[model samples]
Target: MFVRSLNNESQLLRKIAEGDQHAFKIIYDYHRRAVYARAIFLLKSEVLAEEVLQEVMLKLWQSAGKLTDETNLGAYLTTLTRNRSFQILRRRVLEAKTEIELRKDWTESHNETEEGILLADTQKILADGIALLPPQQKMVYELCRVDGLKYEQAAQCMNLSVETVKSYMKLALRSLRSYMKSHTDLAVILIILKII
Candidate 1:
């Protein structure tokens, strides 16, 4: 019975790969709840889990053509969810560490006037860079980086998944770095800001 069920799933995958939207919907309906439950269990955040669910489904749709009969859909989706969750966690840790290092460096610097001037300039550049971000990214960056909210807090405030928050922070930092690099000699300050 187990092997038969596997065979049926494989057939469904094959049909999905052949551009059968009906098969895809069937598979989605069958798996989405379990996938969502797993994501919530692993991430402990409904918002992030929902985001993961959407991302996982989008991946399934985009990669349906590449799935072979041997592909284990459950395992594939599970692994994707786990990987994405870990990625968000890792980014949060790195951001925290960078923030700590920046604070320490800033506090220990003796050249207060020079550092102040540079920071003021960097803040202006940052504001300009932030203006270029999409609204969601800008809000996420402000809540997490500017307002010093934890990921969970920011997620709650923004009504976003932690993963989505992290993704926005990543994009915002990338935009800031590109902008700062091009506009000023504050490359060192940019490094200190380290939005990665």
Candidate 2:
């Protein structure tokens, strides 16, 4: 019975690969609830789970050509949903941590004139570090980190490959860290910048 089910899925996948919208819809109807349930279980938010479901299904449709006869469709969808949910959770945690750190810094510096001077100095150092980056790296860092763009969006904006954007971002971060370590006494600022 299991083998028969796998065979049926393989047939549907092949049809989907061939651009059969009907086959895609059939598979979507079959799996949408399962995907949504898994996403909700993992993410604990209905809105986010729905978004994940849409994203996962879109990816499935786009990558259908890569599916093979040996693929277990249910397992594949489950894994994708789980991974994406975890990614969102991780991002939310990081954002919360960054916000808390920022709030702590703001509270500490609320009334200290010296803190204002230090912040100005840190900004100058950061500006200098940004100025020193290679042009491509600077663009990537600014787009993805400063402007809050996703890697894919940055790649599109720059007409570069996603991997290249990622590489440039990595290099840019290393350069900034090195510059900060060498020239600044602002360790907390460095940690905050690193989060960005």
Best by lDDT: 2
- Indicate the worst ten consecutive residues by lDDT in candidate 2: 1-10
Task: Compare the candidates by TM-score and give the number of the best one.
Answer: 2
lDDT of each: 0.77, 0.83
Clashes of each: 0, 0
lDDT of 2: 0.83
Error of 2 at 98 (Å): 0.7
Model 1 bad stretches (over 4 Å):
1-7, 108-196
Model 1 Cα lDDT, one tens digit per residue, 32-96: 88788887887888877877777787678778878777777888888887788788778878999
Estimate, for each residue in 12-89, the C-alpha lDDT of model 2 and write its tens digit: 898988899899898888888889999999899997887788779878988989988888888889889989999999
Error of 2 at 190 (Å): 24
Runs in model 2 with CA error above 4 Å? 1-7, 108-196
